[model samples]
Target: MALKVLSALDVAKIQLYHFKAIIVAGMGLFTDAYDLFCIPPIIKLIGRIYYDDKSAPTAVVSNLVAIALLGTVIGQLVFGRLGDQIGRRRVYGLSLSIMVLSSIACGFSICRTRNCVLVSLGFFRFLLGVGIGGDYPLSATIMSEFANKKTRGAFIAAVFSMQGFGILASSVVTMVVSTIFDATSDAPEGHTPDEADISWRLILMLGGVPAALTYYWRMMMPETARYTALVEQNVVQAAMDMKKVLDVPMSQIAEDSPLPSSPPPTYPLLSKRFFRRHGRDLFSCAASWFLVDIVFYSSNLFQSQIYHRFIKDHDPNKNGYQLAFRVARFQAILAICSTIPGYWVTVYFIDRIGRVRIQMIGFFFMAMVYFAIGIPYKFYWHNHINDGFLVLYGLTFFFSNFGPNTTTFIVPAELFPARFRSTCHGISGAVGKVGAIIGTVGFIWASKNQKKDEKPNPERMTVALVLLGVVCLVGLSVTYFFTRETMGRSLEDNENEDDD
Candidate 1:
């Protein structure tokens, strides 16, 4: 079997295995989003149950949001490198296993004291983050490796699109749980602390269910042919796996056939040769992703608060289940109307429009939308133009998915060699998580400080929005200058694997 003829995979027709691969890989991301984004709608509920004044302390809330992100950084770096050194299939199940156990632990984090319970939940969530982090590189690299060149971007983006559904699922689950508790409670207000406690635990724990269900399928998947052939220098095994998965006659290599000469040796990850070839691409992918998460996670994690403070006035009377239900409903609505559609649109057009172009357009509009809202937030809020505000705000999310969010995940997988693909993707993703941590902590701190002053200041939020707008522009600049188009190209072509 000749390694150079690996184009059998690049030219393979769309088939059952490709879709199966997407489902198996995408489910991990689904769990990632559910666990990460679910916190915002329920954070206030946690405060009401755990604290005396029905408000979570600023530090506690910050840690709750950022700690898992810290774990995610560690997981991405560790598991990503392991995927390259060992194999993607070997570590994929381990990450999912960690996610399942940690999610259940977070749900069952009951302790005698508030401090004990908070610590338990925080630790478990950190573990959950590590698992979620591992999924980024493994899923993207796997999907890209399996896909035909013509639709590779769409396939990888489709895997990432699962995050949108995961986010939507989180909202829907929270809404359903809060509604059930509200209906069953004896009090007319139906906002009891006991109900709140039960509702949040159920929401966090159920995130594990999807990942648990997919574990068998994920493990059943074979190592990608690219990794098997190019990385391990085993063309025979690569061809056998390809024939079995794609069911293509040409892919069947004779067991007794002589192996072809190896491709050029892969450079060490930190070697000067590797850096000279891919350093800028790596920086471009990492920087663009870093900038995207700063805006994306900040807006996502605090949208409930943003809804109350900026889009609509907070109803002082509504607390506990009533407030949580409203927040969840809004989150669900936003997910359906903008977030989900944005992702699928990118999935549809990514391979056609190309990753760099869509990313530039996304970042450009995102910056414009941010400025539109931030510069005139007071005008819109005070004038009761909430609908108009919502429209502009929603565009940011729409562009985010349709633009850099999808591209960042896809580009890193394409821009590097098979041997280094997962490791590089993991590094880019981990840097993005660093941006998420900064965004999550910074936005929460600003929002919390405003609350401490006992006045909801729209101006402060406007400042945050303006800062995000600036960051988006910088992302746009990075994309324009550094990222390359990867449409209609084989993985080998993109990274010069043949020349190597």
Candidate 2:
């Protein structure tokens, strides 16, 4: 039998709806980054307000960070499968609603005792994490399915790049809010109880606004033609929906036809056929993401500690507002200098240079940077050469978004069959979150053991940095051996499914 011709969606001209889809999906990612990274500074404020300590307990902070990641893992698995089983558009709005409600709950978290407050906050964050997790598979799959093959990589990269913006916004918002409160308060030394309480609540609650704004558009999105035809066996409806999105005439698709009457070969996710076809690819995606995230989440979340180490005469006596402002300022600088640009670079070149090549370059550069910083830690520290350290550190962030961070998300969404696309992406995302949990918890433990009066412990930080370099090298190897380049190829061509 001859292969069926391309459908309207596969060959559709790039149009305004493509950009709109990117924004609707991209905003969810923006919310994810803001909600996740914003917590670090607020956690510091929570400590000052509730416990009267400069930082929260190591165990408490670790839990606060890891619990949301845990929720994300579960949410990804559940929502990813549901997307395939039901439909992408049907389940898309549900996650945003979860985020809106949870963010509000987190902001309003209150209790009579410190422990109760912490517990309530963690609970809400976990729920928020679940919502954030759902966005991963849904947005990635939706964007990929909607995009034209010629520019799919760039479109997806554009969606992922919103994360950098989200991170930037978190820092900017924190700085602005803290500045306003500090200027108004009459308290000379530190944040008053009321000031600290109100500030943290406002920061958290603001995360919900973006997610809520995107909800109407998310509901209006039609199910992907690929999902409708392949999974639901509704080729006519799929054609109509694709016509709406692509703005092509129905006559253009009249010659195109449904898939074969004979069913495609079925393989359970854990079965041998599945492994033979996709096992290595899945392992490659999951493992590379796991490795990158260990450094990515830990380094980004613990920037406060890194900034404090950089500045000499770092007063142990600074007030809460002072500490929060400085951290936000430094982070904002890093985001502007390297983080945001890295994401856009990938968007510009992903289709031209290909995903695997870009990822390889990113990992190789990241490994080199980590080694440079780790081996010279003592020299950099003792000589107070923080400017040098900061440049190298910022380079790592640059390459990370430009490299494995973006590729990991893109590969899983593209490589798998539609039946399993969302599930596989979810699984890949969940694995990455597991690495995030380990990294966050491990860093807290490592940092806590260092003596208070000593200069930042170069020896201990050296070990962590070197380990990150090794992990990047491992990720590079996996990308070389297992992952395939997906640029300029239709989803049907990549999967080789019969279109009848």
Kindly list the per-residue Cα lDDT of model 2 for residues 1-500, writing each as its tens digit. Answer: 32222356666788999999989999878988888768767766776777664566656767887999999999898999899889999999998899889999998988747888899999999999898899899999999999878888999999999998888888888889888887887775654445678898899999888879989999988899888777776667777778776778778765455556755457687588787778878898899888888878767433544645652114555555666677777777888999999999999999999999999999999999988877776566435556776788799999999999999999888888888899999999999999999898767654544566223355676777778889889989988998888888778764564432
Q: How far in Å is the alpha carbon of 24 misplaced in model 1?
A: 0.7
The models' CA-based lDDT, in order, is 0.82, 0.81
Best by lDDT: 1
lDDT of 1 by residue, 185-291 (tens): 77534234565777888899999998899899988888888898888878777877787788688523434457666664756897888787888999999999999
The per-residue C-alpha lDDT of model 1 at residue 492 equals 83
Query: How badly does each model clash, as a count of residue pairs?
Result: 0, 0
